[model samples]
Target: MNKGLLFSCLLVAVTSVQAAPISIPYQGFFQRLKQVNKGNYPLVEIAFSVPNKSKCLIKSGTITTETESFPLTITQDQRIFLPYDARLKSDRALVNLDIKGSADNCNISMQVRAKNTKQSYSQKELLELQAEMNTMLSDMQGFPMRYFSQDIEGINFEFESGSQTSVKIDGQRQVFTDKLRLSQEQLNKLSVVEFDTKPLVISPWTHG
Candidate 1:
């Protein structure tokens, strides 16, 4: 069992469920990137854990980078929200971040216009995405056979002619094809994803 646990994405999905509203789990650390559109739809990518079976809802969270800042909010109903145009105007957009605290901590950085085009997931769909990514990553890089580690290394993607490497920030193997202007529909059968040249990565813990 290489993936005994799935931290971030699964937490978001489970929390969204009416029966499974998320509660902060530990005083540890976690990281995730979330996307929310004006429609209130959310897409999540995480490298950490939520308060497993605890009693806190992610009303909102944010991350700051050298050039930008990205904040995420989850409504009581668990709708993820990110205001991008608002972030672009800010001094620092999140380049990378990590969460560490006695409270629930999850790091997230918004990319590709947090609102440009968000894809929401049904419970089944969200689980499918996580399963798909995990399976693929195991094939490409060979994940650990016994357990999953909180710190996922070498999960970034580099474009052929691009100078920057876009870390898939989320530990899963799937990529964002539509965001890359690639053919998402045409590759319906393939599990591979492409990253935008403008990229982000997973860092360590931030006390906040």
Candidate 2:
């Protein structure tokens, strides 16, 4: 099948789950895997979020390829990290999700992430990440829609417990323990960001 067609099929399958199992195509999975590999990330996660108002629960799941089957472990937060397997790059596979109730009641997404809780990043890398994140946010809230939408306020770096890190904002060294927030303007003005211990995760921070 054409790659585009396969992707379209996968989208349709994910969006219209009804009472049946969700089937993700090999092509889609491979594309995400390739992204992780290219970035040198340890794992890619498939996350399912069930709305608080919804009663649906995921019962079980498995990933099956042409040559192997692996049982999936769904976390308490309803996320499953795809196991890294070099063989998956060359094989056809499908991820099957079984829901106890209605699959349509849940939201599914995929994210690439680093494995380590602490890792160093250069100033150049931080700037690059800021630019990429800003571009993504702009694209998401572009043109007419941005006028009414409440976009994220800034980027936040979440550190592991008891970890301390520091970054220079406008020539002043600011230290943080649990979390650090950097505005887009601050990120642009940043010259040196020093970390005693690297952050565990970097995410968008939205105002409440």
Candidate 3:
């Protein structure tokens, strides 16, 4: 979604939580541990939130797999999410987003996997949607963020509340512990819930 559209949606669904200065290299979405090694997992999807009142040029970008890395095509002022797939081993991968005219470079390491579910719902189902996620999270304790890095998902529902939680499930049936840290205003304008659990690795700009 475009920044204007997303901001409009946020305004329509205004909450008590106020906005704060969040850094870039934001991981809007990524793979969850339990589903990473699954047969259908996606390679990667990259997204970011630019600083308010400021924009940066995407000087260069690249995705590095186990033993190889390739350049990515990104345009100036392109802020929406993009999908990336090297089709190499996805057990571990690295992404680098070098912003022009800025010192901060966004780097991320994550597991890529196909999504387990993707669905849409009406605005009336917002409460139900959250409730369902809470239930699933309760069963698994909570989902985990990337190790040695920031949250793989940029949107922190509990940043202000500071009651963040994370959990991971392994294929070997092992449970691992990890830690880390949305909105409505414009609900009326929203036509669908747009739920996607598939962790797609987005390429900056591609025609396919």
Candidate 4:
């Protein structure tokens, strides 16, 4: 092959590899555990994300403390469930991800989520959870953005399928579905959030 052609081919190959996704190590304060330790939220989840075209799959993973290691499996949706563990609450933990296939094409990132317990929450408790979630969001934002950006505009709560869960915000009862979005306006007026059934997950929600 001509020297010029060979150089061009090499450049293209390098570019392709460089463009591939890479796994991201977890960082920031483990606020999910703090929320779980509060005892209101019983479940926490570490959710992973990968590009649709990426070949990165998490075969297995572990959350290890100084003395103990807990084996965990990622679900099809790329989620690892971590139920509230009193031991892990105070102990510092390290998360290790085991990626399947080539590391080059696999780009995995994670976000922590807090899940509601089976018991319904009263207005006071719901407001407390919302406040805690906002705090957690702030911690995750970090640095300049954390200082400049306003708190999350809304709250998105996900409920189990086929379950009838409802929340009354400011005396206005809203039924829950797969996803429920409470806008900033609604949240400002939120004095009462009464849930009939607990939600599966709670997250920050911003309108499109």
lDDT of 1: 0.31
Q: Please write out the lDDT profile of model 3 over residues 13-131, one tens digit for every residue.
A: 11222222112221222332233223321322213333321434455666555576666554343333334332432434544555544333222222111123233345555334433
RMSD of each: 16.9, 8.6, 17.3, 12.0
Which pairs of residues have clashing backbones in candidate 4?
Answer: none
The model with the greatest lDDT is 2
Candidate 3 Cα misplacement greater than 4 A, ranges: 1-56, 70-92, 105-124, 132-208
C-alpha local distance difference test of each model:
0.31, 0.53, 0.30, 0.50
Name model 4 segments beyond 4 Å from true. Answer: 1-57, 62-70, 73-77, 81-107, 140-147, 160-177, 188-197
Per-prediction backbone clash count: 16, 0, 25, 0
Error of 3 at 207 (Å): 39
A best-first ranking of the candidates according to their lDDT comes to: 2, 4, 1, 3
lDDT of 2 by residue, 152-184 (tens): 455677775576677555456667788988776
Q: Count clashing pairs, candidate 1.
A: 16
TM-score: which candidate is best?
A: 2
Candidate scoring better on TM-score of 2 and 4: 2
Instruction: Give me the displacement of residue 55 in model 1, in angstroms.
Output: 2.8
Per-residue CA lDDT of candidate 4, range 1-208, in tens? Answer: 2111211121111112433232222222244344334444334333444433336566677877779777866676666555455556567665565665565555444444555454344545555555665555444343212233355555667777577666665567767567777776765665656667666666655323
By summed lDDT, which 10 consecutive residues of candidate 3 come out lowest? 199-208
Worst 10 residues of 1 by lDDT: 109-118
Worst 10 residues of 4 by lDDT: 6-15
Candidate 1 per-residue lDDT over residues 1-208, each given as its tens digit: 2232332223322222232222332111222221212122233232332332134345345555455445555443333443334433344343221222323333222221121212222334423433344433333222212343322221222133335333232334344431232222322334433344432321111011
